[model samples]
Target: MEENLSGQLADAVAQGADEADLARARAGDEAAFTRLVEPLRRELHAHCYRMLGSAHDADDALQDALLRAWRGLARFEGRSAVRTWLYTVATRTSLDIVEARGRRALPADLGPSSDRAVLDGNAPLTDVAWLAPYPDAGLAGDPAGPDARYEQREAVELAFVAALQHLPGNQRAALLLFEVLGFSAAEIATMMATSTTSVNSALARARKIVAHRVPPRTQQRTLRRIGDARVREIATRFATSLERGDADALVALLTEDVTWSMPPLPNWYRGIEAVTDFAVQVPMTRCPSWRHRVTSANGQPTVAFYLGDDAAGPHAAWSITVLTLRGEHIAEITSFLGPDGFAPFGLPASLP
Candidate 1:
């Protein structure tokens, strides 16, 4: 099978590959090139996603970077490891994309959070560049490198990626390369065409901004502290409460300061009182039937919900709600409303 071949090739590369395949790849052998870079594709795509805040943008950036690498592979002397060189190319490519398009944002960034849920959800903001959810299924389980400050799962948490968008492009790249990808200052300077001191300065500023925006601990660490079974129990209980229209049960699981937001809808709520009111009025009362399957997204517990009544046919895909926990309680709920999110998680389009 293809997977077996890829595993064999990765093993071969790990044991020490010769210059033969590199030469073939440089000479325009597509299969040879595929073999050479296959091991790194997942992580490279993740890096692009982190930089751009959208999976679609990451796909384009990664494709462009790979094409550039193929064309320039011949010029690659024995200066650096292939992984580092590819990352340098990918990082610069992402920077170029950032220079043109700028950062992505959520509804919260557009304006202040509404104290009460807007009963009539605003028109979907098609024009705004919003952050997209990442399907955690495809993540590379290993850290980018040994020196990475964050674990692989820790780096891709929703809050971390959202906070990253607040930083400028150069600062973003510097911080990612240093803290996430584990590139040393000297190496990152070479990639960014800047001095080590400049890289350090950028990293310091980026870190300060990120620290204030992101929580003190990462979701991955919190999940580890809670254990998988407890996290699943919370997700299942929340989903069941919605299905039964049990507002009290839902409120019991949420923190006093729990926040809820639905993107594209531009309506959000903070605190248990506001969230409960929104949940009862909109989700529970409006939608008559509910079905949910537990899933994970952006390194957090999530539910893929379907809503409909017998008169309307099968239950249709509704939203993918990602939960942010503060210890045992749900601290934040980002319910990304729209059926478009369903396919990525391999969820059913309709539940009978």
Candidate 2:
């Protein structure tokens, strides 16, 4: 990690890095540029995740931001710290993507559901793939310090990010800048090329909308405790069952009216039986000797699996599973195999 973070561009961001590093990069020093930006990889990735809702987009955007940052390094002019400038580039890039897609939310957003049991407010919008909750563990700092002051739970929670999506892209950017990143209104105004008043107005409206949509503290706490314990228990049991191919135990953890879907796979499965049939009789049957290792994803327990001895290398990443727990059972499971899906939740590249 140190070697990776200490390259040429690394010299650029170094405490007393010679101004010459930037000058050299400007003259086309790829090594210098890489060094300058490498240290920010994790933070930039997390920032992208917050803005884009999907780790995949975050990874892509982070890549784009780094590439763009390198290309534009000479022009950076120390207007802001390299970090802040990179953030501006990333946040804008993310909002552009959000605006282009008009943002995403689902049926759960349109109505309440059991998901509400885990949050402080209304049901999540199912149609919308809201921001996946980031693990508190993802955050590294005085967890209680002002640096981490954004409503940690609410900031990355699926429902809140979904509410944020409802706001215009600029408003979402403003809120993240002001509330999450602690940027001043004037700074945000400059970023969005708007007045302080516009930034303030957008934030006010965003907050009001968020308040109504987020769950109450009392409700959230109770549900969280119940949900947390249940989720961990279910994930542990679920993984054990899958390892043993215990069809009965596997079926038992699923809710009677559960739903399971594999994104990028088109069809959705409903209820325990359908899920059971699909898991056991279909894929599991084909890969009878498969193995799984537990990791975390989307703020939930996730299973990262591989088949045979050839599963450790590149492109071998299989399904990335996200669970929804209710009591001692899982109510829903989403198996995401998108290339970038394994990130953000901090699931490893391969199981040990």
In candidate 1, stretches whose alpha carbon ends up further than 4 angstroms from where it belongs are: 1-15
Residue 51, candidate 2: how far off, in angstroms?
1.9
TM-score per candidate, chains pooled: 0.92, 0.64
Q: Write the per-residue lDDT of candidate 2 for residues 47-162, one digit (tens) a residue.
A: 67667766667778888878778766767777666667777888888877876655654334433333211212322234545344344455443122144336544466555565
**Which ranges in model 2 have alpha carbons more than 4 Å from their true place?**
1-14, 18-28, 105-148, 151-154, 160-163, 211-233, 242-261, 264-291, 305-318, 324-332, 337-352
lDDT of prediction 2: 0.63
Worst 10 residues of 1 by lDDT: 14-23
Q: What lDDT is reached at residue 47 by model 1?
A: 90
Clashes of each: 0, 21
Cα-based RMSD of candidate 1: 4.0
